[model samples]
Target chain A: MDTPHPGPDLHPHCTIVPPYLLVRLAKLDDPRFAQAAAAARESLLRDSQIRQLRGGEHPFTYSGARTLPARTPGESDRTISDAGGQERLPGRRVRAEGQPAGSDPAVNEAYDSLGATQALFWTQFGRDSIDGLGLPMDATVHYGKQYDNAFWDGERMVFGDGDGQVFNRFTISPSVIGHELTHGVTQFTANLQYEGQSGALNESISDVFGALVEQHTRGQSSAEASWLIGDGLFTDQVEGVALRSMKAPGTAYNDDVLGKDPQPGSMADYIETDDDNGGVHLNSGIPNRAFYLVADALGGNAWERPGRIWYNTLTGTGLGRESDFAAFAAATAATAAQLHGIGGAAHNAVLQAWVTVGVMTGRE
Target chain B: MKVIVSRSGGMAGIRLTWEVRVEEQPDPATWADFLNSLPWDDVTDSEAAPDRFAYRIRCAPHEVVLGETQVNGPWRDLVNRVRAANGM
Candidate 1:
């Protein structure tokens, strides 16, 4: 018997993880945290080297692999490809710039998301694309048979048809689009290594903006926002609301097989593990909570003052490849101070948020 | 031999594991041959891509970890069989 597909999740936004998880970097006097920093660095170097060594392996069939920013000051350049269930990438050109919606839901959804994400960076942050120079967004959908994951390969966004047991489809959630695309943005900007604390930061950065992309499109305030990542990716068989909750960490889901949400919103409960890049997805709960707190305190559209502070810190060049949670917290506080004056509402909100999350020791 | 397959580090950061006791399978010899066919020596556990599933396969004393892309051919064969045997 065939099951009726409920279709793609329309309003919900979800982003899964891709943390490097080497050493987690030392934080809050915890000497045990090497979380995957070294491995993360090694992997990043190896990935770049692989790119150089493994050229011509993927078929560059599409001409819009990168659409230039010459059309207008803020126009988006996008290309969507279909893998047709083979493992190869950038499979075949199915859609291009300014194409009408096709019968396939995955293609249409990806196209709309790319446009929305591009619009967020352009209108809100005055930035061009994933890169400020207006990098064209490229994505491949329907990759592999029941391939339950979506990832960014430092070049294009690759999405898969979920197994239909636990997940629906990668494109079901708009936040996932923002989340994966934000990984591109992070690579272009701070380029945080994906392991441990920095890895968690990498994941958190994507979630922060992933939610922002959703909120901006829906015009929802911080209070009105769901603050849940991967909200509707799970099937009815799984007992979960979303993948992770930014407002309340570790409260997103609880299932018999998937187990409970292992995310921790504070350092005291920080999970130290060798998997998930030293719990890059788990420990990210701390920073995600911090951002939510900041937005809650600011009491307006989160994309306005709160997002500006985050956007400035992200592009300010203050973050290093190995920057831990504390360093990132300090940078955001400084950015808030510089932008909204010391002891001002935004600055205080940043400090209080970090302190609450145990990233920073005090309200400094 | 007991084979365990643990999947972690995806977009959701959730982990699911399944295992099969090769000795208890209907065709133990065939399962062992398939398990032994995996390219274990070539797996370097350093490279991890963002938001991809990482698999840890442990068959007795020999253990190997592979990213999502590497789980094909013999590797995919081993994982799928294990999950099926375990009724996962």
Candidate 2:
């Protein structure tokens, strides 16, 4: 709680200066290095007190102003850290790439889940990592005290331990991990504005590939896959199977405390609201159901053609930052035609799925 | 004062809401002071982080939606105060 006042410059070298060195610098009695000492203290305070927002959510869609980190061009480079019940991020590195499994279940689960997501991208779409050039996939677990959420803070994934009353530990589900990691992928690519349809699309994209990651890992066919985004996250006390069900959007849960799942399966039922960033989480069910239909129709492995279409459309230059359901559907259809031929099964499936989901009227 | 605290937009995509009447609390003056002490006009309207817990805290004419990162310092104190008052 002893947060020091930030220095004039705001400590640009906080990352380079180790915490121990920063601590020593912060306590040094030198007047000349007062700014340096204050900067160190500010950095330390950031680590101690604040939950780093990082770029403050990039108010506008990326217009190529922000360049992602350079690629490593190999296997996934990962680092898992522990927040130790604090709101700080990347708290302390507990597991790194190629390290043996740690004793903490959350740490190991995070490590494995990240690897699975990386493997799905690489093995299926030739994507190297979240950014496709092998950007490191890192995560932080056990963040905050009984924290009930997991988020991608533009740079890395941060997970809460969950309240345990309604939700279990977040790391218990691989799909949740995949969902968070995909946000990084979205950030690097479409950079969808996190509001309204675009925000819902942002949420839906994460859920689509998220479920795919788990299915790819289980080697389950489309029918075998649960199509639920947070499968094991709910405690038995909560009357829910998962957070969002792609197969049946609003049917994921109906509880007294959590209330009925407010998601709509089609444009006919799309919710219009200002909360949750224009109901990004609620209206996402429309696209989510669309993706599910495509996967179900394709029938062997959902991540193959269906996954390729979604992934390509996301990474491809067809989408705008503010792409609506129709626009994204059109983009996906274009991708399907590009991947599979025009009038082909994959292309046809996408058309029918979008039309059925009311994302589009009909194929041109 | 009547205050509404609603959290939404996490990875779970769940929304939880609570309504608190400061007048009904043991100390109404402190609650008024607490609400006045917050920077209601300084809230950033954009999404702060993906899937991070955010709150829509409204007190009559003053209302703001804050991302988890913004819900620190005095913001955190206000939120915790509301939650504690609600017995959450």
Candidate 3:
């Protein structure tokens, strides 16, 4: 319900679903959802005013070519941070002394993701680190006790050791870290509100950049890359697949604990919800599938034309804090045309990707 | 009050907990009322001790079993407890 913006930006970001999801939840079968929705709406209204007052200040600063030296390795090897950026002590199972620094698979995964995300911005968009100022990267792996989620807490990224039944150590997956960090990147760039369809797009952008980072890191072509978030975070005990499959949105998980993966590959099947910051994770499947379509259509390395198109759009396009799927689609197409000539493969891929996702046809 | 809620049984395998102190001898009925009044359901059964009452709350995305006690009782109280005590 809190808009990412500070004030007067209540309708800060565009959402795939109407704000009516809160309205719907308010009328849900369960009294709790109704209460939760009512509370969320109140906060949303309050956040609207807050956003109005904090106009035009970037959450993350921009500083090209500035590099902050990494902190000297501290004796207290493990550190954790909360959603609001307050640091916490590490748990025993993930004690820094128990595992060698950067040697732990989780630590390595975090480092690699940070590197890849940083490089993508630097190489493709000329953007610095998460704050675009080369902010010393800070990531907390194994956050919370059996924390089942990973998130960017407006400052640093945090990973969770999944319950190991439905999910594995989030740090095992580079995309997960990249996805979280990209939220910081988004915070700096567009500051997209993490609610409704705009929030979904925000989530989708993280996924898109996440998959790109993985592909770039592995030197995998778009055709070769799995385009799966949390690919390595699923244990053998889990069901048929990884966290969220870009190639196949709804087929990620079907376990009893998490129910079915509620991702939709197309606009027609989009999920509308008020949970998880307006269902940012759930509705992301639509745009995730759209990116997959674009990457597949263009072929070769995704970080090539498709990546360029996206990176250009992300950095250059005047995407509003409230930009929606259609707005994003247009920007991508425009970026593709700008980079690879009008009606080029990149441009065509953008149109085709959106069309496959059942957005507007005949790019205007 | 300090309460520890450990969740070893569940599909998520996530163990999360937070402690709350009510500043008085915790009545089982009052504790039960607080638990029952929650907009959630408990996944595990619980019991009360001389110094504390414990409850296990199971929810996907977050799960924490908890114990509670009066603030100025025995025990130096942990840093987390101190934060909780100070209502941080």
The digit string of per-residue lDDT tens for model 2 on A1-364 reads: 1122222211111112334445676797777666666666666767633223423222222212112233444477999999999877779998889999968999999999999998888777766677554567889999989988888887789888999899888999999999999998887767788889999999999999999999999999999999998998999998989999999999999999999999999999989887888899999999999999998998988888788789878877677778888899999998888877899988898999989888788836
Instruction: State how far residue A102 of model 2 sits from its true place (Å).
Output: 2.2
List the TM-score for candidate 2's chain B: 0.90
TM-score of chain B of each: 0.89, 0.90, 0.24
DockQ for the candidates, in order: 0.63, 0.56, 0.03
Once fitted onto the true fold, the runs of candidate 2 whose alpha carbons sit more than 4 angstroms away are A1-72
* True-structure lDDT of candidate 2: 0.82
The DockQ-derived docking category for candidate 2 is medium
Chain A superposition TM-score per model: 0.81, 0.81, 0.74
Give the clash count for each candidate. 20, 0, 19
Clashing pairs in 2: none
Candidate with best DockQ: 1
Error of 2 at A284 (Å): 0.7
